[model samples]
Target: MSTPANTITENPPPISTGVTPQRLSTLRRWNIGLTILHLGQAAAMLILANNFAIPVLSAYTAGRPGTIGLTTSNLFDLRIGWAIALFLGLAGLDHFLTASFGRRIYERDLTHGINRFRWLEYSISATIMVIVISMYWGIVTINALIAIAGANVAMILFGWLQEKMNPPGRTITTMLPFWFGALVGLTPWIAMAVNISLLKDENLPASLYIILIVQGVFFFCFGLNQWLQYRQVGPWRNYAFGEKTYLVLSLAAKSLLAWQIFAVSLFS
Candidate 1:
């Protein structure tokens, strides 16, 4: 049979790890939907930032305790909602760009069995969370705050490597990188816990505990998602399943954090 002129018969190349056009379409829709959700949440948080935002304190210590040139550290207070907004919006931007540019933006990520933008978002958002926790526990020294952020960012990057170095068809038999990342990620949380404990739980805000529990649970879920993906457990055998799970996790984590903060700082 002779082909008709200008007939579209050839299939477009898949984006990211040989994802089919159908899968790519599904992913694009998923990105669009999640982007809307993230942006919506971010907008709400931003609006609330003006009056309901939580206090985030930053300090600069002039010298070590009891040392010469020691000066009273000046604390700078910032709004927490703004941080939340940025966190949510960064992820929204990731999804927005992914959906908008489709293949061009997501090709590398999908090809590598990872989302670089996701890790990048986490690097910022998760760092913010850690910083908030640190300040809440009075770990406000500039050096300590920087270390916390650096550790969190490093952990997130290691997570990126966890996927980038072990894509599908590569026979990924171990998840050492993920475990190591988790270990590294534990620093800030553990430090927070120690600080809380040392303070003897005297007059601490109940919201602080709530934040810890909620964040801890979601952090575990994030690790579980990656582990399931690596082990190819059940539905996770499909890369798209893992991807979808990640999207859900991201949304749930951000939403829970935002609402929890809102409940304490705004609605209360």
Candidate 2:
């Protein structure tokens, strides 16, 4: 009788490159999900901010003859909510798009260090930070342009950071972008707290309260998701700084958002 052919097959060698197909797919899915979630948030907030608050402010100004016309203070308060919502929306989209790019980079297994993508990350993070700061400082001239630039920068950075941190079989890099993204995303919310004293209107207070609550929910989910991803990828030696930073900032952001909502509700 002919000898039976061995049924066993040899195992394939490990990939000696940045990231793997499985991990890349997971990251892509995460990025896409984050993008969708943020986009949903942006759309919802836009509706509320524009449809509800703007109209209320308009009516308050037009209907009440003697009421101080939309004061600088009122405008500022309204804009604060608008800016936060807008930032969240843009950041969400940025994360999704950048992660997509990162996936491409990882797939190609580029030889350069993460620095290759640093410009992209820095551009996005810096631009977003600038727009947020400008809005806070009341620099309206290039706010829209800045917002767009920030979004683009953030997406590029997402890709760059992903490539830098998550080289194949590595867990540290995978979580880094999520953590950084959370921190960067939280900056606007933190800045908004400075103006909490300015939102004096009755309706505006209630609306803002709701928005803050929504923000909290958003970040809470984001943090939890990142943690889960970390669990899946196992451990690494990088400074846990990113995770710690994300948690702290996320909690702070949630707290501020909650406090504002509570403060607003008290008046209502």
Per-model C-alpha RMSD: 6.0, 12.6
lDDT of each: 0.77, 0.45
Best by TM-score: 1
Model 2 RMSD in Å is 12.6
Output the number of the lDDT-best candidate: 1
Q: How would you encode candidate 1's per-residue C-alpha lDDT over 1-268 as one tens digit per residue?
A: 9999989897543333436567778888898998999999999987765554334334444667665553444565557777778888888988898888645668556755777777887889878876865766778767778889998998888889898778666743568889899999888888888888789656768987888788888878888898888887888877777787888888888888888877776555
lDDT of 2 by residue, 85-183 (tens): 554555565556556765566334422223343244335433543353333323333334344455545644654565456543553535667666666
Stretches > 4 Å off in candidate 1: 1-18, 50-70
